[model samples]
Target: METNTTSFFCLLLLISATVTAFLDIDELRNIKYGIDILNKPVLLSTQGIDKQLSETIDVTSKHGQIYRCIIPSQMEAEKQKEEEEKIAMEAGVPELLKPMESGPCLFKTRDWWSYEFCYGKHVRQFHMEDGRIVGNVIMLGYYESEFDWKNETNMEIKSRNKNRLNRYHSQQYINGSKCDLTGKARRTEVRFLCEEGTGDYIARLDEPETCTYVMTIHTTKICHHPYLKLPSQQKPVSITCNPAVTDQVYQDYLKE
Candidate 1:
């Protein structure tokens, strides 16, 4: 685990909690259990599964504030690592501790769709629905690729260097546990991401001892969802009569 990264995040969380308390919503959504991020709404998660994504990245021999990349002293770096590890292990607690899915699921996608995007630099600062006041989210990790877009258009990603690949890192964030996007305040999530390059790790470095870029993500609801709680699943449909599912057996059944 990147100890400095932990300290950095803890600082961010501390500020967030204070902000949450000050704002004092009716009730914060308790996110529990490892969940289907895209398929399901941000509800809750338990402790992490047996093996999960690494929350740590080797920021460098030195770690710095999330808003800026400043290397810490070696002695300071070591101390920070231990402290960060403690907090990460504690905060890394999965809402639900279970075996993750076998196939690439919610948080996972194909490489063709996931390619190197604008890496290295990102935005912090999230806005409350009322843009007048800023929300507590100090920094957010932003990342985007054609992965989700592939379903929309027929296209492919071409990566010459591995540094442009979105392979290891997963974008995770605690968006406002519940947001009132709809007419009623709805549960919300402020997702964060890290930027990773597909090129050789060594190639990315100007100096071997020092680290390169750290990615921060930003997000906003494009249009108002208007108080509808995100649905966990769509109504079960008759796939057999989907017309698109015209297998021989289905066709025979249709005839019958």
Candidate 2:
């Protein structure tokens, strides 16, 4: 009789433990099947569960539990940024060039002429008199859609050690205002250079030929690369002096 009672108690405990495990699993399942505010489906993964609970409103489930399935605001922003970058790269855009694509224009002004360059867009030259616009805008060039910027490797610079050469990137803008003299449309060649510790800006602009323009831009984006360094950015070499020779020299100078 004692042995039968012990076995019956053990069976009851096993059934209780199994029922408790099932209840816990059912609660978790309810949490995972929450409704999203955006009406999109939510994943049931660990990270997804955390997002759902944090971003959605609680709703009653059949098990008398609250559940939600909304993505967090921070995670949504990150996903948007990543998608934009991916699209930009697929269009042959460089990472450093993205910031300039949709912001204020990069400009440099010289005597009576202010040159404005909108990256991957257009270039304009206008006259500003006494801080106010005075004359019609001269379109230097518009962005050339057919140009392949990724393969543009024509610009080269010789390193300080003249034997070494480095290739850089450039943009060619064309189909601007018609040139009176050349009988062709004006064009501009914008060159980008890597200067350490400087923000991106138009360093200089010149009309080298009739209706032909050259614009130089300096930026830090291209820094740190071996082949992208300018001739002036050579690494410094350290010098050392012998202590005994220095002492002897000091003594001779003192005697003199």
Candidate 3:
């Protein structure tokens, strides 16, 4: 009886350790905590089974707003499939089964695209949408002459913007949160939401940085164009624009 009790306790310890280890890894891969200011529709959690893709990421806006955005989950894919099937059924047509397409199935092909903003300097922004969640990453190349890359004060000011672009452009203000800034890392996390409308609502950066800024902009216009090729898949191209030219070109693309 004594031996059996000892073995049972050992088994329990092993099981506890295994579960703890699994949770640790899951927590590290996904952003289990924090709120996305962009008003993305998905709940924030690290419970997703897919390890290849992350469910949440930290983003800093051009004006230095930091926030977390949730990535689409495997559950979303299942929901999309079911919706498609339901549509087919309603149309009195048998749903055709198709092989799952290889590659990261985050957003619809029509909605996944990228573009470069070239004013005095160039910045690249990529938008990836999967259902209601949209992931955006903006890369601002380093300029050594402007300021020292390691300057803390400069970095802070450079990352932050005083004016709220969302309101200026007629977007409704939503909730937002900011994370603490620490160490030599010029990074912070903040998020907020703005009312989306029919206008082209592209997140813009006023100042360029050597570091990257990311955000998830929730809007229906994200996937409005079906024919526009994503910048990654297209040949090398550049768009040179002033403020007016930029607006015109972007609007024209949407019309197409």
Query: Model 2 over residues 1-256: C-alpha lDDT tens digits?
Result: 1123344334335444222111233323222231222322222222233532233322333453323323232335446655754554454435566677877898788887998999889999999878777878989999885334445453522332244333345788999999999999999988776676888899898888999998888777655333444553222211111111233544665576
Per-residue alpha-carbon lDDT of model 3 for 1-256, expressed as tens digits? 1123344334335444223112233422332222224322222223333444434333333454333333434445446655754554343210111111121212212235554322212334466545333564533332112211224374453354233343111111112122133212222111122333532223433223323243222232212111111121211111111111233554665576
> What stretches of model 3 exceed 4 Å from their correct place?
1-193, 198-202, 205-207, 214-256
Q: Candidate 1, 51: how far from true, in Å? A: 40
TM-score for all models, in order of appearance: 0.15, 0.48, 0.15
What would the TM-score be for candidate 2 when compared with the true structure?
0.48
| Per-residue lDDT of model 1, residues 185-216, tens digit only | 11112222222232121111011211112322
Shift of residue 120 alpha carbon in model 3, Å: 32
Candidate 1 weakest ten by summed lDDT: 220-229
Q: What TM-score does candidate 1 reach? A: 0.15
Ranking by lDDT: 2, 3, 1
Better of 1 and 2 by lDDT: 2
lDDT (0-100) at residue 143 of candidate 3? 16
